[model samples]
Target chain A: MRLSENRPSPRVRAGRELPLSGKDLLGLLSEVLAKGVRIRFRASGYSMSPFIRDGDVITVRPCKKTDLRKGAVAAYVRPMNGHLAVHRIVGGTEAGFALKGDHEPIADYPVAASGIIGVVDRVERNGRRVRLGIGPEKGLVAALSARGLITWAFRAFGRNKGSVT
Target chain B: MTDRTGLDRIFKPSEEIVAREIEGELIIVPLTAGIGDIEDELFTFNASGRAIWKGLDGRKPLKAIIGELAAQFEGDPEEIEEDVLGLVEELVKRRIVVEVV
Candidate 1:
């Protein structure tokens, strides 16, 4: 599957708005979350493809560290850059937890329970909204993400979709 | 009635408002409704707004804040007071700024 597939296309400018860097946006997100806020933003990138499209809007809620389980999708701070990263919790380690992008093969640096910002609760796609929680779909996705096979599945789905024309 | 110009009244940032500084820019988010909803709009400030926000310590009076701002920038005290008062009034209306007893 092409990397840019399912991405939001560039649109014409309506008016000039102050530009915010990714770091600034994440910092703002963290600040609001600290204040017990729930936030949503249009998804970007292909890290969690098929499950979460680039233009899909996601709603995240503050959650307890213990609430997260393997195969759950979460937003966390990357230890290396202190930036926000959204990925699936494939498994856990003695240090903390192991997280990986659904589209990437490698697991990211293990993040402490405190490093997690929130858990995704809802995703809106094509005017339809779906709530995410412990369920069969979550379990299956978790299993696939844990084994690093989600990318392959996504690729297969993409090829099949492309051939449908 | 309390004198509005008195420097004795304390003015503090409302607990309902949360703010942060990133890359020299001030970002203000209001959490009055218990939590900040990302769907709500956010307020961002540049250099001038930063200057005014930094002066909102609960201990400082409105007059004193105006003086400090006037000394820091080249604007006349009258103009500064007008601008500061306008912004502070808006903040008060939004509950982003509160008066201390």
Candidate 2:
């Protein structure tokens, strides 16, 4: 049999999307960010929906510990399973910062500063830039999300369709 | 016999790229734009490609790499040379690897 006959051809082209597992993604993120370079990838879930919808592209920049402020959307590694998540910083806890998905009801377990990877700097949808949850109003959004009022407000305003409440 | 005229050319990986191997695959993230923009552009190499990539240390010539790979795998020397040259061409075109001359 010929060697490499069955092996997949090497690809180094544009417009190709690699389906990376959570672990693989975390490894890639850590490696790229450590080089002081920003990374951009398509968001995969609706957990931060309406603001960051599925298929939206997000740019994450290397962040220092002092940058972990309330209302900032951060990419972090979950301690429970070592999976990576991008959520909003809802509040501060004794251990670290509290993170929560805007569409979710409760905040995730506190993530230590070291567990935090980077901060989301930009979001794009349909080739256009999105500045909804990453703007100056982020503080207000975080406060409401922490109190579990953002969903109620969305429901009250009839913007709850297609969003987890 | 394969045409080995340019086999002595040396090439090295660019400084604007970061690579990592996960699950037996090599993932290359390019920083050509000073940012890791993999949203639309991403590069991945399989086992064969990974073997070739590891040999590009800015010191080894193309012929040496092809010889090493030929000795390790059961394949025709000419075909192995073709594969290596083909990959190097693509890498050079994308600025991932640059000729050391």
Candidate 3:
């Protein structure tokens, strides 16, 4: 009559998502990428707008320092506060590499190779893969961003009105 | 008291998962298609769940785990067994836990 009435259910509950601080997320990403695994998370800012906007899903792959190149978008630990940041590699110096946000006028301080976490390999928006900013034109974009001319060019050409990555 | 068949089995967390304990909670991310998609596929366990998770070391049988938990938590042995077995079954179903041969 009550064949399963004596059975007790499991109490373990699995959550679908967990919110993490910048430091905590970077810690997890560093650990996972060190294991040669790739990670994907939603982007949270507009610093790399047009190319990588807010709420875009980004995939980062593990790479050695030797794999870094100018124009490629990378995730690195910001020296200012030790938080994680994703920006474009605008140039390189003896100290390290120069990174700048596409919409910002200034380049961040040189980031050592060790501070670079991983390279952004893919970006997705609205279930579609966005390919404009991370493509071959990245070199030109980096060059423009390095000179603090990206935003100016967008404003001058009236391309900032639409998504012109 | 129900199904005792799984009592002697030992289960280990799958290699496809990356787990870390932060702030007394166990956070787990499963690598789907070789990518750790934290935005949509993340899991967390509470304190008691963490205790059970720690006992699944691949070297301890379910019976021993149940005994240890029962002793540590001062709960009924039968209730602990049910909880452990229930969690293990769920983990196994999700492919997050694998039974060691």
Candidate 4:
């Protein structure tokens, strides 16, 4: 018997696996960071897709408020829902910083500088470490993100499917 | 004479374990392997587990913890000791808790 034949389908696998919400993972991440530890967690949503696909592993390190800047990817708590969001820092406000997913249409609710927990330093995809901020993958993704092509693509897909949310 | 395997050992919460209280539940994440996949490693504690976890503050003996838990919960002292010891042993194996001198 082949092992591949025994593998469960996506729907069945999803059902068998326990679901961990973004808020739950973020709560643990925050505590680990507070203990001065670097943590890695799997990404689970399509908000930051293409650049960060679902199931991709992300390595994040504790960061200071001064370490954040526009164009950087930071993990922050969305005030509206208290859920964690890993999004790009597009701009800043007097109160805090503005964030948006690379493929999101609109910016999320502004997160105060204090609410920002860690900055993503590396992303693991297909067992390879793609360092953020400097590299070919970074350059390509940053370019795509800068021009908002990913967001445009997402919107187009939603429009075509008539499932725009 | 010490009871030996009868709650003489003192254990403390491992520094490698990071815990959070969310919505009145205790969630523990063991940071033994730095930068490893952590979402897959989270362990949430139940009401009884939470009681045992909170008492492992590096200063309390296992016997003291058992006494407190036994008072809060309804059970025989020997049975409570057995359950607490079993849970602690499991946590020790997972590196979430450590036995201290």
DockQ of the candidate models in sequence: 0.14, 0.47, 0.29, 0.15
lDDT of each: 0.69, 0.83, 0.80, 0.69
Order of models, best TM-score first: 3, 2, 1, 4
Which prediction has the highest lDDT against the true structure? Answer: 2
Superior candidate under DockQ, 2 versus 3 = 2
Question: How do the candidates rank by lDDT, highest first?
Answer: 2, 3, 4, 1
User: Sorted by DockQ, highest first, which candidate order results?
Assistant: 2, 3, 4, 1
Q: Residue A124 of model 4: what lDDT?
A: 83
Model 4 scores a C-alpha lDDT of 0.69
Candidate 3 runs further than 4 Å off:
A1-17, A156-165, B1-5, B46-48, B73-76
Q: How many backbone clashes does candidate 2 have?
A: 0
Tens-digit lDDT string for candidate 3 (B2-98): 2325688888999878888765567788875878878677777655666788888989999998887776776567777777888788888777888
* Span of 10 residues, lowest total lDDT, candidate 3 chain A: A1-10
Q: What shift in Å separates residue A71 of candidate 3 from its native position after superposition?
A: 0.8
Which residue pairs show collisions in model 1? A71-A142, B11-B58
Worst 10 residues of 4 chain B by lDDT: B33-42
**Using Cα atoms with residue i matched to residue i, what is each candidate's TM-score against the true structure?**
0.75, 0.82, 0.83, 0.67
1 or 3, greater by DockQ: 3
